[model samples]
Structures are given as C-alpha cells and as structure tokens.
Target: MKNILKYMSLAFVGGIIFASCEKSRPVVYTGENFVAFEDTLLSIPESSAKEDANGETQAIPSIATIRINRGSGDISKDLVVSYSVKAKYVTTDTLGNEVILGDVPEGNFYLSSPGAVTIKAGEGFAFITVTVVDNDQTDGNKKLTFTIESTSDASFTIGYPGPDKKAKSMVLYIEDDDCPLDINDFVGTLKVEDVAIVSTPLEHSYLVTSTQVSPNSISILGLFDPVTRYPSPTPCPAPVVLVFNTATKDVIFSPTTQTAYYRSGGCPATTNPRVVYPDPAVPNKFNTCQKLFTLNYYVRNPSASGPFDFVYSTVSKP
Candidate 1:
C-alpha cells in the first residue's frame, strides 16, 4: 500500500511540472497581418523622352504607379491603408560626408488621393498613381517619401521590420528633365567671365568661340592669356575641350585632367587643370535654357603640392 501511495505522489508532482512548463512557453503569433510597400525605392522621370521620326527628341507627360502589398491577410474583406507624406532631410554619415538627398518641393507632383489606398475585396494589392509636373528650368533631382501610417483593421500591421530593423517606407526620386542639351545651340562665340579666387581676386572677361567636335562634345578656341591678361585669339596652342553629359547636364573636361596652358619662360607647367563640381548644397549644371555655364575648377602647376588657383567661370551665349 505504501509503494502505491509513493507512486501516486510522483505522478501528481510530474503533472504540476508539466502544467508549469506549458504556461511558461512563449505564444507563437502566426496569424498577424502585414501591409508593406511593394518597392522601397522608385524613380520617376519628369517627362518621357523619345526620338521622333524626324530624328528629333520629343517630351511627353510622365506618370508613376506605386503599389502596396497585403501579406497574410483575409482576402474576403477590403483593407484600407492610410499613408502620410514624410519630410526627408539630408543627413551625414559617420565620416561626416553629406548624404545628398533633396526633398521635392510642393506643386511638383500630384497623387491620386491625398493620403490613402484601398485593397479591394479578393485582392492582395493596391496601387496609387502619381503624375509629375514638367519644369522648364533646370533643377536638381528631388525625393519624396511616403510612410504607411495605419490600417483600418486593428489586427493588421503597417510594415514588417526589414533586415536593418527599420520599417519599410516608400521613397520616390523625381528626375528633372528640363531643357535638353543641344550641342548646336552652344556653337558660336560665347562671352566668358573668369575669376581666380585667391587672396587678391583676379578677374578677366573675354570671348571664346566653340566648335562642335562630336555629337556631345565642343572645343573652345582662345580661352585666356595669363601673361598678356587678354583673350587669346584663334589657333591657340592649347584649346579647352569639354564633353557634356546630356542625362545629368554635367560638363566635364574631355580628358578629365588636362594642361590648360604650357609653361612660359620661367612659369611652371600647368598640369591637372580640371573641372570641380560644386558642393551638394549648390547647383552645378549647364543651363540649357539660359545658355550659360556656371562652373568651378582648379588649376595646378607642377611645382604646387595641390591646386594652385581656384577659379569660377561663367560662359554665356547671347
């Protein structure tokens, strides 16, 4: 009888321990619903450019489609997702380098609705349409961000945590497509104002004639005479050749780095004269509408450890 009683006590204690362990187990959530952007980043051009039959380029209005996906959700019921426009700012990295991201200004784009999308019943996705306004003047690229705020159903989660442990947000970059570059327009005599930024600034104004070398390249004759302090005439020993990047509208030196001028009687050899793009905070581009070039560059001599002189030049065609 004592043996049977001891066995019963052991069985009762085993049952209590099993119950305690069952209570301590973490609850697994397998039915959680999540809604997230189909794509984290998207790009929309300001206009659609296509080559015409006449071998000329034409521009058309552009539109973008943004999609939102519903994951592990009941398809029998409609899900309403609300979004909000979030302001994006330029930030710096650990090295203190600026991460260049410019926000889109108002009136540049239009959305289908103020801030919402609805996934219809029996559907797993919804879309939002965006139309861009064409800009006649040159402006740098801009970005817009939309964040999923909430869902109509309390059981649905907005976004799932990504590998970075941050919720997914939709980021759209708007490309500026204003005033396409035409090399023919730049062929002629252009008035230039070059200023050397030194302890004592030196300024010179002259005219340089540009000739088309290729479809997107131009060679300018007679840049400037450093010794005479005047505009060099045609048949200059060293002509400045520039290549234009039609997509980004950036003007670059053809050879990337070249000798602007040869050393005179006692002057050091001019080496590594190249165009330096402006800072991210400033606009650096060839203005097609204005027919102007605003550029910054540095001239280095063989004797100089770094750049010898920093110069800002504006070449405009009237």
Candidate 2:
C-alpha cells in the first residue's frame, strides 16, 4: 500500500509539469493576412535640376517605397496592388502650398510602368518610380499624389490611417529651381566708400576686387588697401572669402585674422606684428543692387584695448 501511494504521487507531479508546459507553448496561425508596414504612405521627392548656364530645368528620377506585412511566413503567392489618382488629389492650402496627386505630377511625370505593382513571394515590399520633368517653368509650386486602390489579396488592407493623413496618400512637392542671385552674378569690383575707423570718420577710399574662387564662393581681395593710418605707420593687408547664398542674395564673410604692422626703421624685420580682430557682433548683409558687407569686422590698433569702430560697404559691383 505504501509503494502504491508513492507511485501515485509521482504520477500526479509529472502530469502537472506536462500540463504547465503545454499551456506555455505558443500558438501559430496558418491563415494569411497582409497589412502596410508604414503607418503612412509617401514617396521620396524627385527633383528636376536646372541647367548650369541657361538655368533650364532637367528631368530627374524620384522613387517611393511601399512595404507590406504578411502575418504568415513567406508564402508562394504574389501580392498585387492597384493604384489610381484623379485631379481632386491635387489642391492648394491657404498658404499657396500645393498638394498634388501622385508623386509631384502623377499624370504628367514620365513612368515606365503606369498602373499596378506586384510584391513577389518571399518579398514584402516594392518600389514605385515617378518621373520629374523640368520645363524651366517658375510659375508656382507643383505636386504629385499617389494612393493605393485595391489589392489582389482579399485579406490585405491598403493603408492604416494614423493621426497624420500621410498613411493614406503620398504627396510630392515639385520645387522650382529659380536662382537669380549667384556668386558669378555679383562678381566684379566693389568700391568701399564712407569708411569709418575707431569712431572717427575719415575721407578714405578703398576697393574690394571680387574674383570667383569657386562656383558658390568669391575671393574678396584688397580689403585693407587704403590702410587706416592709425597708431601704426604700416597696416597689413588681409583678403576675406565670402560664400553666396542664392535663396537670399546674402554674402557671408569668412572669419580671418589680420596683422597690424608698425615700420621698424628701414628694412622690415621677421618679427610678428600686432593682431587685428573681427567684431563678434556685426554681420555683413547683401541684396539685389543695394548691399552691405563687412570687409573687416573689428580692426584694433596696437596698444588699444578694444576694436576700432570700423565699417565698410560696397560702393559698386558689376
């Protein structure tokens, strides 16, 4: 009787362990269902570049990626999705910003394949290509919009709408390539007039000879030609480099260090001269015709604790 009781207890413990193991096992679903991987559907911007010389717009390629999620493991079935768009897909907001159907210009943008895209078995995503045309038109902003219509898989859904409407439709804005202000456009000799140094205005004349150092930058030479005859007899000349921003005809000056020298009797010695500093507060400005640029920010004389009240402007530029 004792042996039978012990055997019965062992059997009960084994059964309990087996039942717990069974309950912890994961359940697998054999049915197939697909969903969009992204909360929103959108395409990357395809840009049309303008010609270097004539500013003519050129056709460029833009691509948008569409990904799908299959609940079931890789299957031997092809998932096909159809996309459609109409004129109503394109609209402008109160701010004049336009949102168009497709990728910038769905109907107008050139495409190799127009309609349906397929997601092959074992693959969960596909790419959609949109053609961007540069017609040299700068009238206003343009756009293209693309939306998923129907899928071949009955259990598959197009998109999941989230807080942002981007999940349902993809909109691409076609930016205009309009740049009237470039470094080359403003290259020439700029005269410096009404010069002031260290709070004392003086009748001094200087010229800033601007030469194109690069496509986007210009080298401004002869900044200290009519050197300020201040506490020193000889002042060192320093050239400043400037970069041109097209959107705003703004010329940004690069920070540089200049040396202020005093004549040492006859032949100049190899010793280093006094240092001239750039003002931390002042920044140069430029526009279409009327422009204000800093040749040298804060120029200090030898033995002076602070910078001289220095200001220079472009008298003329061609």
Candidate 1 has its poorest 10 consecutive residues by lDDT at 1-10
Give per-residue lDDT, candidate 1, residue 263. 39
Instruction: Quote the positional error of residue 205 for candidate 2 in Å.
Output: 4.6
> lDDT of each structure?
0.62, 0.47
Model 1 TM-score is 0.43
**Model 2 lowest lDDT segment of ten:** 1-10
For model 2, residues 183-216, the per-residue Cα lDDT tens digits are 5545787766546654456556555567887886
Model 1 spans with C-alpha error above 4 angstroms: 1-30, 50-57, 87-99, 102-114, 161-167, 179-318
Index of the highest-TM-score prediction: 1
Q: Per-residue lDDT tens digits of candidate 1, residues 24-62? A: 674333455778887889987778978889989887656
Candidate 1's error at 214, in angstroms?
26
Candidate 2 is scored at a TM of 0.36
Query: Which is the leading candidate under lDDT?
Result: 1
